[model samples]
Target: MSFINFEILATSIVILCRVVIISLERLFPYNAHQSLLRKGFWNDLGMYTLVQSFVLSQIIFGFAYWLDGITELSSYGLLSSWPIWGQVLLSLVVHDFYIYWFHRWQHHNRYLWRTHEAHHSTEDVDWLSGPRSHSLEILINQTVEFAPLILLGCAPETIAIKGMLDAVWGMYIHSNINIRSGVLQYVINGPEMHRWHHAIDHEAHNMNFGTKFAIWDWIFGTAFFPSGRKPVGYGLGDENFPENYFKQHAWAFRRFRKK
Candidate 1:
């Protein structure tokens, strides 16, 4: 399929995934009391998810193209010889691995945490919560994400397919739907583990950092899956976190408190 056609298909899939996830959340919610119009919902949906994503996609793709121009890497078509499915699968595993480590680092490194805290500021951890990432964080991660595909000459449609997977998995892991993956949770990540990543609980702090796969956490001894209990709360412990979109972005730049 052409890139445009693939983009159309990806868009449809994303919309379908959002609808299905939202419906499931209503039917079997983990946090049954959390409302659809939770606090900061408009800001997250209107500004971060829609506006920031579109604007940054242009900038990230432009940067990747500039880098490719200087290196002329796409001309070699390094990954083009591989089947499209192979390229997509390879990109997913490689980038998922990269994000798993980077995500863990974000929770530990105070400096990087500045670009990451906004993602954890939401008191209500739902499907929309996943996209509430800081612009700098998204810029860095996505540049790392798509740049590889361009540099290695993966099929152009692979980027769209991968992006669809990212959006769907992101929403799935953050959705409020109660998921009992049991053994599957050992391999694939879902709300069961990821919601704890946003939890304010002491035990869950800095644990379950995998994005698409749970094997990283299990392998690295950071997996915190306590059965028969739920997180006491969500979000950063700070009650003073900003609510506006622009203020939230600027909040990441504020001077850190000294010890």
Candidate 2:
């Protein structure tokens, strides 16, 4: 299948999943107070999802094609040789592992943290909150994450499938809809687990860095699971950042002035 076809199909699936998850959340009772519809949510979502995805997709595809000439990294050949199901399972594990460290680094490194801070700026958490990322951060993170898959020769279809899964997983976990998984929360990164990760408390803000799987956090000792407590607040504590999208982008660069 072509990249365009893959994108359409993948996007459709993700949208469908979001709808189901949203509906389910409405039916079940949980904390719905924290929603992305509040201040700064739509602004960040519009830029990151609508505007930035288009530009970044073009840049990433162009760069991937350019690098294809110098390397034998074609997404077509890898899928043909492996069983379709196996390819998907492998992609999920590998991609999640890659994202685990990528996310961790963004928090630990000052420069990356500057760009990543935009996502955490929102006091509210919801489905749309996942897309509230810095454009520069998205570009850098996606490029690095895609490189491994491309070099490994995974088919474009497999990559598309993995991408869609990640998108839905991200949106679900970031959503305001509260769903509990009991002990499963320790193994997987669900909404309950992820909400705490966005908490204003230093401990909550610093832990739960895994994107999909909780294994990485557990392995790295960054995983924190409280028995019966929820995060008191969300977003950065002392950062006097602007609410404007363009200004947020600019603020990422201005971090150097502090040094």
Candidate 3:
């Protein structure tokens, strides 16, 4: 019951933050070249609303708790003794490490890439782009990410904090707002680096797999940042990628169709 409350409170904060950022972007966009509804807004919005709502998250969190039950885990020993803030920070680090590699795998493995390609199908990447994902992708991510949080014995409050931060930061990194973080971009993941992740060009597309921090990319040598320019745009170069949420969810399987 408490967990449900945390989910609601934390997510409400994320949505409020999203409204603020979108408002800022409208007033001061990074690129006048992009439109407010930059292609595929409805598709992304559909997924975003679905995931942000209680119904989908309740299912995902309920599943995560079930997985935790299977393992029979809880905050224990050293991790339990740590302050709540420490626990949350460590949880973020561990979770992001898994996410970085998992995200990279999705790009390299053809089968996984099929599940992720819908996210890349959007030509206009921005705040709402983070939630524009396939159902499989969301399920896999929640499970993978949830497993570590449980194994590490993080508190529910800590998980909520990380979840809120992840949601808000996820939107921030994918945003189109004119933010030039300069050296800070090296320390934390920012729109500048993330936009490169969405680049249609192969060279840029393969880089910057980090979710919250750039340290993983810096260590893995996958970070790419060009001086004085943004990505030409975003997408897989497939005109048939589909603009509808339902179709985009299944867009990956089309490759297996027998002619």
Give the winner by lDDT: 1 or 3. Answer: 1
Could you tell me the TM-score of candidate 3? 0.88
With candidate 3 superimposed using the best TM-score fit, by how many Å does residue 82's alpha carbon deviate from the native?
Answer: 2.6
Per-candidate alpha-carbon RMSD to the true structure: 0.8, 2.5, 2.7
Stretches of candidate 1 exceeding 4 Å from the true structure: none
Candidate 3 has an lDDT of 0.79
* Segments in model 2 whose C-alpha atoms lie over 4 Å from true places: 1-7, 75-80, 255-259
Best candidate, lDDT: 1
Error of 1 at 237 (Å): 1.6
Q: Which ten residues in a row have the lowest lDDT in candidate 2?
A: 28-37
Q: Could you tell me which residue pairs clash in candidate 1? A: none
Error of 3 at 16 (Å): 2.6
**Which candidate number has the best TM-score?**
1
**Global lDDT for candidate 1?**
0.94
- Residue-level lDDT tens digits of model 3 in 47-165: 55564334556777787778767866663533667787998877778778988999999999989998788777778878888887777887788767665666667677877887789
Please provide, for model 2 over 84-103, each residue's C-alpha lDDT reduced to its tens digit, 9 standing for 90 to 100.
Answer: 56887877777678878878
Q: How many pairs of residues in model 1 come into backbone collision?
A: 0
User: Which residue pairs collide, candidate 2?
Assistant: 75-155, 126-175
